[model samples]
Target chain A: MKLLKEKVMAEGIVLGEQVLKVDSFLNHQMDPMLMKEVGSEFVRRFAGEGITKVLTIESSGIAPAIMTALELGVPMIFARKNKSLTLKEDIYVESVYSFTKRETNEITVSKKFLNADDRVLIIDDFLANGEAAFGLARIVEQVGASVVGIGIVIEKSFQPGSKLLKEAGYRVDSLVRIASLENGTVTFVEGE
Target chain B: MKLLKEKVMAEGIVLGEQVLKVDSFLNHQMDPMLMKEVGSEFVRRFAGEGITKVLTIESSGIAPAIMTALELGVPMIFARKNKSLTLKEDIYVESVYSFTKRETNEITVSKKFLNADDRVLIIDDFLANGEAAFGLARIVEQVGASVVGIGIVIEKSFQPGSKLLKEAGYRVDSLVRIASLENGTVTFVEGE
Candidate 1:
């Protein structure tokens, strides 16, 4: 978590009061080394839980989800954004409202992947609005599966998503919680 | 490679004539252990190729790309399908036609992630028409980088993508190359 916070402070760019572009390493172009640390940290936090699968959204979350799955020795299922032709399975569906993009999109997962037997760990790159994480959790529930824990690499405490998840009675563990990002400096929350 | 082949024969569902969905292990729901074999196999195939980066398209390809990058000890950059706010810096954009979807979509990657000095290894989940693979290759070429090799988990030999890639002079290696899927049985090419 310290390594992530340090990398974020050193390289993260704040475009506006809301936008934090970390394409250099976090999302667009991934850093496998940092992701390994992220995986270890997530495992350290949620290793006690019996996680059967790692669920994540497509695009950004796939990188960290794969790392976590590798570390946890479990399978990772990435929900596709669009109704792509390659995947024809309509196993489960959930509607998520993205506060960052200011758009709502339907995220889907094949039912063949997750079921009631699965104890899932929802992983995401960032937890701001928490819509993506919620969407993944929704899919898990649809399959009658239990969400053991939600592992987030970075959580923007300024938003209400984290509180929303916690209010839902789910154990949400974030590596680095952004207390504030004023004056181009990041303040990380020290405790859960 | 035997493990991959066996997994494919066991789980791979051939849809109609050309579609082979391996999402059970390779793409949608990723089998992390099998992906390790894939990454290691790729490393052995292109060990001394001086691959500085591993490139692929988003969604399904990210898992394998991460595996290869971890094995190669390099960075991994994934091309985005649509315009997104998260992507920053200069980008190498290309128009890709999805044969399955019967539509065209533009893929973009931040230019800062890849450059002329990079020796890129293109990795993907499936190769039917090879459009996505070629799209990544084009991005590498536009930045004056060299593509060391192109790795495909499953290659449909009936499709013309592999032919096109071979004609274009790329060292294309597929773990399981299907000669045909007649009557629902997959025939893998020998000495592939």
Candidate 2:
């Protein structure tokens, strides 16, 4: 977690006190070395849990989820933003509202990929309002699968995301927890 | 390459004689173990080209691209199909026609990510009509960066993607090359 927090301090950019853009290192452009360490940490955190798979949303979360799945030695299933041509008919879907984008979109994963047999760990890049994570959890419930935990790379503690996921009884582990980003200065949650 | 070929033959579904869906093990649902091997093979093929960065389109390509970047010890940059709120304004953009989605999408990467000093290796899940790969190549050209090679998981050899890329003088490598899906059977190309 220190490594990730340090990374956010070094490379992450603050956007007008609310948004933290980490495209330079975490999301758009990935640092695989740092990613492996983060993946290993997720495996360590949810080691004994019945993690049958790692689930995430498309595009941004795909890379880190893939890395965590590799570390956990499990399969990864990503919910697509739009239905692709080859995807099967049976699906588990949920609508997630994005604050940054100022819009809502549906995320879906095929029902065949997830089922009652899976105990999944959800992973994503940013956890701000918790809409995406909650949406993925909803999809998991729709498939009759158990969500073991949620792993996040950078979390905005000032936002309702962490509180929301925890209130839902999901173990939310954020590697970098940003408590405040007032005036372009980032402050990580003390002792976490 | 044999491992990949075997996976394609077994898990890959043939739809309408023209489409082969390997979502179970490739795109939607990812097998991290196989991705590691595929990534290693990509490094073996193009590591000597002095690739400063690993490039790919978003979603499916991010997994293999991360694998290769991890092995090669470089950063991975993905082109986004939609300009999300986090996307930078100063970007190199290209329009790509998706054969599967049946529409054109603009893919963009921030200008800060790539420059003339960068030598990129483009990786992707599938190469059919080559529009996605060409789109990435165009983004690279826009930044004055050199595309050293292109690696694909499955190549529909009959689709003219490889021929078009090769015509542009880019080194394109596909792990599994499908000669034809004739008579309800797949015929793979002799060489990898």
Tens-digit lDDT string for candidate 1 (A83-112): 667675666878998887778888989888
DockQ of candidate 2 compared with the true complex: 0.89
Worst lDDT 10-window in candidate 2 chain A:
A84-93
TM-score of each prediction = 0.96, 0.98
Chain A TM-score, cand. 2 = 0.97
Fnat of model 2, as a fraction: 0.95
Cα lDDT of model 1 by residue, B38-115, tens digit: 888989988889999999888788888888898889998888888777663477789999898898889998878887
Tell how far residue A169 is off in model 1, in angstroms.
0.8
Candidate 2 lDDT over A14-114, as tens digits, reads 88789888898887899999888988988898889979899999888888888889987899988998877777488777899888889889888988888
Docking class of 2: high
lDDT of 2 at B12: 84
In candidate 1, the residue pairs with backbone N, CA or C atoms under 3 Å apart (3 or more residues apart, or in different chains) clash, namely: A91-A111, B90-B111
DockQ of each: 0.75, 0.89
Give per-residue CA lDDT, model 2, range B14-64, as digits (tens): 786679888898889999999999999999988579999999998999999
> What are the runs in model 1 whose C-alpha is more than 4 Å off?
A190-192
Worst 10 residues of 2 chain B by lDDT: B183-192
